[model samples]
Target: MSALDHIRKLHLPDGARILDVGGGSSVLVDALLRENTSWSITVLDISQSALDHAQTRLGSLAKRVTWVAADITQWIANDPVDLWHDRALLHFLADASDRATYANTLRTALKPGGIALIASFSLNGPEKCSNLPVHRYDAQGMLATLGSGIILKDHWLMHHHTPSDKVQEFQFCLFQRV
Candidate 1:
């Protein structure tokens, strides 16, 4: 199975609250919702235009998913989340402080044993995406940044097939908050 397909199989519970960080145009949440009617999806992004586009694309499914427009660095949730889904977001946080803040937000919002599925540009991936610099990660580097206490459940190196059929290498790290 594909890396993304494997991520979908991560053993998230039914009726779980999932936070999709930087899930602007990502169809991952849509696919997850389709697979499990009981799951609640919340898509968070810094761009309103992107969120609007996602809503339009989701159509009726949009109502079932919550949309939040905010930078991940300043994100905080009143309720804890069961899963934190972050793909192609953490890599953009090249600054040490920004990455720390992003990590803290996730730590604060996630319940104990909550899962985090994060994907970052791999060492072989493009140097830039969307005209922005990105930080590449090997498995250990990504885990170390998130710190200890979180148990690493699994990891995989895979390539994403873009619209133009270009392939982008990435590392997916799964963790359970302890």
Candidate 2:
């Protein structure tokens, strides 16, 4: 997606460790491998089914990725990563406590100056997805919610049409650890 174009512009070091939190079956992993196979990429998800699906989809290239089956709020990485990307997970943290844990985990997982690319439902987007309530935010609201230590590097909004023919607004924010 356009987000990756911006990420690619970062010109991260070769063999940089990247973590895709709550990324389950996203073609980003595939595209990333195609772009640079040297980067160590880890894809984490709470669902075994999703991971399995991704593994199946990736086929032989699946070995190139580290697949972790765990909840982001409860999971901790053994080592820090240079870049973190999340596309499908944050909106589900409707509970304040859950958001705090997620934010804390994010802060802990990154190396200093590391990059985080997060996407979520915008304030003007849907209030819920799959019948679960979502917490929505504009760029400033998201920056406020994340609080300290995260510097807002860039942000933008994009419109997505679902398979069911529904319009959903997505806010993409890029942050760097200070």
Span of ten consecutive residues with least summed lDDT in model 2: 1-10
Candidate with the greatest TM-score versus the true structure: 2
Cα displacement (angstroms), candidate 1, residue 131, comes to 1.2
Q: For each candidate, how many residue pairs have backbone atoms clashing (under 3 Å)? A: 0, 0
Model 1 lDDT on a 0 to 1 scale: 0.86
Please give the distance, in angstroms, between residue 18's alpha carbon in candidate 2 and its true position after superposition. Answer: 1.0
Query: lDDT tens digits, residues 55-158, model 2?
Result: 99999999999999998889976789999898858899988888888888888899999999889999899999879999987888877777799999999998
Q: How many backbone clashes does candidate 2 have?
A: 0
* RMSD after CA superposition, every candidate: 1.6, 1.2
Q: What is the TM-score of each candidate against the true structure?
A: 0.92, 0.95
In model 1, where is the ten-residue run with the lowest total lDDT? 1-10
Clashing pairs in 2: none
